[model samples]
Target: MIPDMTIGQLTTEASSRWGEIWDPRATRMTILLLCPRKERKMMELHGDMIEHGQPVMAVFHRPRAEAHLLEEQGFDPRAASFQFVNIATADMGPWMQQLVNNEGWLRSSIALNPTPFSVGLPSQRPFEAVQTLCFRHPSLPALEQYFLPYPAESLPGKCFVSLPRRAAAEMARQQAEVLGVGRLEKPQPPAPEPAPEPQPAPVAEAPSESQETEASEAEEPASQTPPEDTAEPPAEEHVSVPLPPTAKPDPAPAQAETPVPLPPTPGEASTESPAEDAPGDGELSGSENIDLPEVVEEAEEISELEVELRAFFQELIDAGVEPSAFMDDPRWEDISERAVAEGLETWPILLQMTAMG
Candidate 1:
């Protein structure tokens, strides 16, 4: 029978027996409880660890067969809870060692029998009379402890443990059910809203021949009108007499042909100044119109950059890396700098994209 012990005692015992096999430089530790798959029991143990502030990273359900293979294959479980852990500490080895040492509730919760499993037994076989615990690390041998009195009729499942932020924990629960591991106790995530489709730029159409003709015809009447302030003699005042043929005998026909000037409009000035009629320097003329093409080109460039940024985030997701946790990676610096230069709200955009996913 396993003795009851506090978290500190469990840590000390584990360190003394397996310290040599532990890698101090490792950033993560995987703990597997080979107990019966009972939701109530799993929740009790998870809640106890949380109540004691044990840095619980994540908790989910998986087939016992699959959980056992994790140690041998070294494959990532892709649990979302691990995203909350800050893995960028300088002395990750010591930090992880400390984490292992503090898992007293974890040790007590699964400690069933004092004897380890016999060598060469197929791990795939159902637990007949014993339960086991495993502490797996990358590049290091796994540390295991055995427990007794595993009920024969208990279902075949294992509770997987890790850390999670509040929302991420809820998501993990949902994923566990969706993947057919946990009880169908949580609701699936709602379908994501579709992303807005990009609209094409407007194309400028050339004027047709008929439209050009109508425009030119509209301008002819305006051009024919006289200036508003100009004065001219009435048609009635310019009558020619029948004596016009004989009038050519006048002494000087040139003097007689001299035109008469008419009085200016009542309130108008007689003096003309070309400068007063022309457009001022401050006013934009037809030749000095805005450079609209350059503005449109800039907008298009920003749109393309946004698309590229979204694709970069998608690549991270596909690779099972959390976008928030990837900030310390070298590749992120370039992306961040470019985003800042373009005035993009990187985090907001990333969150929106991830929500859709």
Candidate 2:
């Protein structure tokens, strides 16, 4: 008959049964186990141990099957590690029940459905069917505040002591920041291309010299002269300077005083017309049109870049990374500009900086 024993008892019994030998007095424990999820928590605990002077050798990896199982359980595969699965208190299994219900053991039993693991012995021998054993170390007590209702088919396994409250909280915050920074979604489809605009009909030049001359003459007179009904310049007046004492006065007869015209200033309108108003050899003719579609395309490209930059900044904020930190850095502009030139997005650049730092 299978013995009904607590997981700790089973492990102790198995260690002896498997002939494994190790010094318990060692300051550090080498833990090689299967941790399908809860990697962050495990890492936090590891860090806490180091901080408290107990160094540990820990290796954790998710089995391919376990990851698939998480998805089947309606947990978002990406977020499963950070979340909890409810398990009934009664479902703690026979071994755990015996351990938790024991009056002598001051161990607290809470509903924390942490991932189970198959351990490696000091000799590195694999523990087969580790799932069948439920170990409860005195050092690793289940907290009452984190209790949850057990989900169907969920079973209890080994429960390790969680990091101290403050340490756990700090770890949680950092985990959230990392998740926010790394999250990515499907990119939207490209916008539809704009329709081609109608081209203006090409203007035909007059071939006959007589017709060209007539057109030129007509354009010249209309453009050069001001309208007669409009204000005309006043008749020019010449002011006479007073005769010097040594100079002779005019002896000619005093006739009607005719106004002498003043010289025109540089900006004043001239009555004479230019040779022609026609387009020169290299210049575009009056009938030529500007390609509006090309200008619109450039504007659209700039607008898209602006949108991408805004999204990248929002992601930085959500991740708890200061967007101003990057913005204030002199290299940020160069990095973004290079990304734009290569047709790459901004989030990759932001992610790289965080990873490097």
* Best candidate according to lDDT: 1
Q: Write the per-residue lDDT of candidate 1 for residues 1-357, one digit (tens) a residue.
A: 122322233333533433333233544333343222332343334433332212332233332333344444443333211111112233233334533575422232122232234433243233444443343323233333322223222212232222324534565677777788868457889999999999999999999999999999999999999979867767776677675454445475454567779876754543443455566643646558756664554544466667877888887888888766768667778888988898887888788878887
Model 1, runs deviating above 4 Å: 1-27, 32-44, 51-165, 168-235, 239-357
TM-score of each: 0.17, 0.16
Error of 2 at 347 (Å): 99
Candidate 2 per-residue lDDT over residues 134-219, each given as its tens digit:
23233332222221122211213333332334544555666777788544667999999999999999999759999888989999
Off by over 4 Å in 2: 1-161, 164-173, 176-192, 195-201, 207-210, 213-357
Whole-model lDDT per candidate: 0.45, 0.41
In candidate 1, position 185 carries an lDDT of: 57
